[model samples]
Target: MYSFLQVLWFVLIAVLWTGYLTLEGFGLGSGMLLRRVARTDKERGAISKAIGPHWDGNEVWLLTAGGATFAAFPEWYATMFSGMYLALALILIALIVRICAIEWRKMVNSTKWRNVWDWAHTVSSWLVPLLFGVAFANLVQGMAIEVVDPSNPMTGVGPENVDLSVHVHNLTGGFFSLLTPFTLLGGVMLTAIFLSHGSLFLAMKLTDEMRERATKMATNTSIVSTGLTAIWALWAQFAFGGSQPLAWIPLAIAAILLIVSTAMTLTGRVRSAFFASFLGIAAAVAFIFTVMAPNVMKSSIHPAYSLTLWDASSSYATLSIMTVVAIILVPIVLAYTVWAYYVFRARISVEDVTPSGLLPYKIRAGENFLTAN
Candidate 1:
């Protein structure tokens, strides 16, 4: 029963992460793509409107994933968060900046202020996904963890006590310690994937000239992301000594979906392209977690210090209660989420966002300089 609950919580946690990557991945992508693909205020507004209704809601997945980890695997959460606090803190800051940028971008009609907000949105968008990529890579690659018994201070070794007794080495080296060649590869691969995903989403949500431009962007980025993903997956499989040999199955599926996604983009199948990108991200995330399962975080210094599923899991009673709660509430969350998306499924266009004279401050393109006069 204990082992089964451990596995179940791990799987649930994995699902949360996968869902975040698939949904919020495009949100981040769309934010960054706002600056890249949108040439005018109307164009930018179109991009913003495309994602605005759903971006905040999409972020809930990340929050839920973090919360689930804290509840289901307290030890793992403690060590991982303490060890990588700097990186995680930066990610938190980026998320805050992103939210601000999205909300404040349209409050004023000044191009200068809007530009400032757009850049903020774009930078945060890129950084958040890149950091997640690097963080997950480091999680899979391993960290400097040292477990010891506070009770047995002199020996610094123990038979076992599950209470929060582990040491996470964060202060000594800081964020740079998390970077490695493999982890760098993971960061870049994830960035590319998010960029591609965002472009595909724009292709799906923007009409006319914006749609064509977004489709082109998706086609170009997907080609590069597909290659990076392949290399990252192969590197992970090789680095781990092929213990989970079957990871190749999903990895292959991911590659195939990515290729199909790009093909659909070329053929002007916008919805199909977006769907493929979403599933491709899910499959890619699945491959990573599947390969790293049973072991939450490995130790860079020594193998014995690794945090396995068994050692890091919460008590059996806690798991049982959380499982019941999740089963009851997850479907309700999904139902509302689906309804929200369905309600806002219409495409966005420049005409849809033209500022009306209803507001006290008039909106005009390039109005910052004129307003000052």
Candidate 2:
């Protein structure tokens, strides 16, 4: 049986991931929509203006989640990082490019410069979600893992020869080896889900023509997203060994909520639609962590090699210290985040700011400014 600390940390890690997905989902979705749904430079600016303030902040959750995993479950972290280094590197690069695009959009006055950055932003945005989807799906499907003893070790003389057997290790075969049908399905579904989420977000944050286009996109994408999500969740239920009955229960509810979200979007209830989408995403996250519990990372090579909560966790003392630190800091972070959103909470429009190629890029007061332009 796992100790209280182990379970708590697992739940905390899951919460961090959920926070990342929920907060970043719309941002990624909005980025993906930049070129497709946004017809004019002003419309694209409205999209960028909608997500600019929160996008970087949203990524902090991912960093926190990764850090938490490293601290709480070093073994799992070690294996996952080594196994998926290339894939993670790609994600990091894409994020860098996307940030450059967002930051550079207003820096230059040339229409060609603005156009180039727009496409760059759009491409990077799509890549982030697509890759993340694939990565998360791989987590659900499990990775090929094994534990082995190091080949060389130091020996000491303590009355006689003493062997140091302190190091224990887990290994993986890298990200490419993890691409399977189920995981691919997961990637596709999440991409669709985020696209739908982005559309809803744009609808809420934009006005007039932009809002109408976003609403239409949200309605259309939600259908595909909901369908794919349902199928993916159901596949995990029947095909995967680790999935639990309780987990499937929430997934079923999430399906219903997603459908409701779609309906609400179609009927022009933008706020309600967005809320439903949020709830659905939250529910899906809950179900995923529920299924992944006990085992932080499953081993496709052999069940015995799996990294269970007990095997992956740090020492009790370490956990206790981290728990205290988190308890003190998490609330402060949350409060500041909430306040930031509240401060920037207002609809954005093309009229709210000058066009991309304008001489001086400037935003009106009380709006979340993307560029110094």
Best candidate according to TM-score = 1
Candidate 1 residue-wise lDDT, 24-59, digit = tens:
899999987986789997788788788889887788
User: Residue 211's C-alpha lDDT in candidate 1?
Assistant: 86
Instruction: Estimate every model's Cα lDDT from 0 to 1.
Output: 0.82, 0.82
> Taking the tens digit of each residue's C-alpha lDDT, what string does model 2 give over 240-324?
6344667877787798899999899888898899989988998888878777766878767766666788887889999999999
Q: Candidate 2, clashing residue pairs?
A: 361-373
In model 1, pairs of residues that clash are none
Candidates in order, TM-scores: namely 0.90, 0.89
lDDT of 2 at 197: 94
* Candidate 1 TM-score over all chains jointly: 0.90
**lDDT of residue 117 for candidate 1:** 85
RMSD of 2: 6.4
